[model samples]
Target: MAILSASDRDAAAYPIQSLFVPFPLVCFTLALATDIAFWQSGNVMWQNFSAWLLFAGLVFGALAIVAGLMDLLRPRTRPLRPPFLSSLLYLVILSLALANSLVHAGDGWTAVIPYGLALSAVTFFLCLVAAAVSARKYARLAWRI
Candidate 1:
């Protein structure tokens, strides 16, 4: 990090929302991996892991959206905030994760194989797409940026 001169304190500052971006991305991505592990080992433990991860992702993702919105609405920070399209994409990513969490709420193998796993895959894919769309900026799944 560069040493900030007193006059430059206002410069190179990041949005508070950007600081929360990595949590959801890591959580959701790990949830997908745990889903695969559940599929492979048929372990109830993996499913439980996924449940917690999804929940964590939801929590952090919500915080990120709120922070982003706060930044966007602030006159001084508006220009530094993410675009509406970026926020929209983050919402979609969260929606998919919420649906995936619901799917994982089911019982046994059926809970995962066709549906839960599918949802996880879809969510992961959406994250990748959003990241790509944002030119890999930390803002939407842009993996939760």
Candidate 2:
């Protein structure tokens, strides 16, 4: 029985994209939480945190998409690949996340307050509440930073 290291792995043995699924979920969910915190406390730090989280989520989500495509393209994994609708859904979510990333990308420096909305790491809790509230829908959201 040969042992497989992380670098020796392939999609047929284990779906490459499976390794990446949890990351976008975690990052995007946390970004939503930080967005809420920034709104609730008027904290620039939370906004910064949310921006970084969104960036990470987008990166991971992109990787997952690439891995999924590679997996699906390979003949060995063809039969095991996810259905077309599910793949389309995944792409849709990634696009939404990309837009969400754009939402988080702006407004680090305050144009309104004039004091500059910046960062403060000491001012955060785990603060995972908004993940359950389920109100961060992209289509219905207003397009503002």
Candidate 3:
């Protein structure tokens, strides 16, 4: 009988568990990038793209949160992964940002756009940090086990 390596075992158990957080992280990054481009070019298409990105980020972020929560609730998962808390925070921040963006976009309120962009940027950084931390934790745990 062949024995599975610790890393292999961990991978088998977790499968795509870690991939969940990256979805929102990437989405937010793209959203921020699109927003910046739109601001620079002052193009209607880029503005529309930025808005779409924000909405898409919200959808993906919500899904990522659900997936992360499910992973956290699993019996074999780590109970104290930093990504879990960070992801939760990311969700809240992104939701607020999305709301602000929607209102601003709908009413052509310029003031809300800055605030929304700022909030989204903060959440984007948080998601990046969380994803890195979570990956590191999983790697360490897998190596140990």
Candidate 4:
């Protein structure tokens, strides 16, 4: 009886609510790894992988940003600064890096891969820090609520 009841409760909570951190962390790490591989290998495979990773990162990052904004806009939710300016700056840098990577991928400009990868690494780190800070702030606000 207890086992059955526990299973029922678990089923009700199938989709865990706090999955925010893992998604971004995975995207950031994969993107960085692909970028680094492209930088080191100079292989077409790595270049392709990096491009896909960049696209995935952009999509996931955009979703995360939208979710955060929605949370901020929620009634009675705590006000967060959103780090919009910093995020935007990083996005611009990332976009440029991605563009460079794409352009140079076909032109035999192997050096551009590392440049883009390095920029992506820095941007990912910044994003991680921003997410941590935002999570902490949100936790506090959630506690108060």
Candidate 5:
């Protein structure tokens, strides 16, 4: 009946995937901000920051994906359906992050600024949607428990 009963949390790594999900969201949002700032202020520094943020987001997203996979493979006290869907949603967000990083890899600031910013915005929105879906699923699961 509880949200996460003792048995549901087997160890420190229980729900580890959730811990990493926010990292990319934060980084990608900052990347968008820096991209816009670069476009407005003509600051090369902003472009550099955006590049680093994108890279960080990808790295963190990879970690999250790994954790999610591990969770999926392990036995669980809770139903796996909602978490599986959540993991799929996270995978989509990670794919977008990878694509956004590749876009940044093109020619310098001029090539990526506005377009990359738009991509980041789209990715961020998707992340929000994924989070919402995951939250709703978890809430439904909790009520059933």
Candidate 6:
């Protein structure tokens, strides 16, 4: 058997998009937590943290979308519509996250005190839906084999 080093390996075999899946989940989840904390304590610091988390989530989520697109468009792979749709859903979540982050960019506690929290809540709900759909799609694929 021949062994391939990391650099020598085919990129498609690595599932780069899957590697990125947890980042936005963690970031967005933490953002929600921080928003709650900011509300409870009236601390500006938590609001600031939530904003940064949204920013990071959006950045990583974009990278993940690119990787997912590459995977979806791979030359020989079967046309997997569910996963493709799941990616589209993630893109929507990413867009919402970007908007929510901008909302947080306003000055002081007013930035994230009300509207930001609401937006974040909706974005996080979409994330859960996306994750669930993707899981279902993966399970279907696994069962087919």
The window of 10 residues in a row where model 2 has the poorest summed lDDT is 118-127
lDDT top scorer: 1
lDDT of 6 at 15: 61
For residue 37, give model 1's deviation from the true position in Å.
0.6
Report the poorest 10 consecutive residues by lDDT, candidate 5: 76-85
lDDT string for model 4 (52-109, tens) is: 6666666655665566566666533324434465456545644654564455455443
State the displacement of the C-alpha of residue 21, model 5, in Å, after optimal TM-score superposition: 1.3
Question: How far is 120's C-alpha from truth in model 5 (Å)?
Answer: 0.8
Per-residue lDDT of model 2, residues 14-116, tens digit only: 5588688668778766766676676668878887787788678778878988898898776655544555555555566566666555555666534212211
Descending-TM-score candidate ranking: 6, 1, 5, 3, 2, 4
Go through the candidates in order and give each one's C-alpha lDDT: 0.82, 0.57, 0.62, 0.56, 0.77, 0.81
Q: Please give the distance, in angstroms, between residue 123's alpha carbon in candidate 1 and its true position after superposition.
A: 0.5
| lDDT against true structure, model 3 | 0.62
Model 3: residues with Cα > 4 Å off, grouped in runs: 1-11, 15-17, 78-84, 107-113
Which residue runs does candidate 4 get wrong by more than 4 Å? 1-25, 76-112, 142-145
**Higher-lDDT candidate among 4 and 6?**
6
TM-score of 2: 0.62
TM-score of each: 0.82, 0.62, 0.70, 0.57, 0.80, 0.84
Give the TM-score comparing model 5 with the true structure, all chains together.
Answer: 0.80
The predicted structure with the larger TM-score, 2 or 6, is 6
What range of 10 consecutive residues in model 1 has the weakest lDDT sum? 136-145
The lDDT, on a scale of 0 to 1, for candidate 4 is: 0.56
1-145 in candidate 6: lDDT tens per residue? 9887754454235465777878998899889999989989989999889989998998888888787777677643333434667777888888888888999999887898789899888888988998899889778766885
Q: Compose the digit string of candidate 3's lDDT tens values, residues 105-130.
A: 75332532576567657767776666
Candidate topping TM-score = 6
- Greater TM-score among 1 and 2 belongs to 1
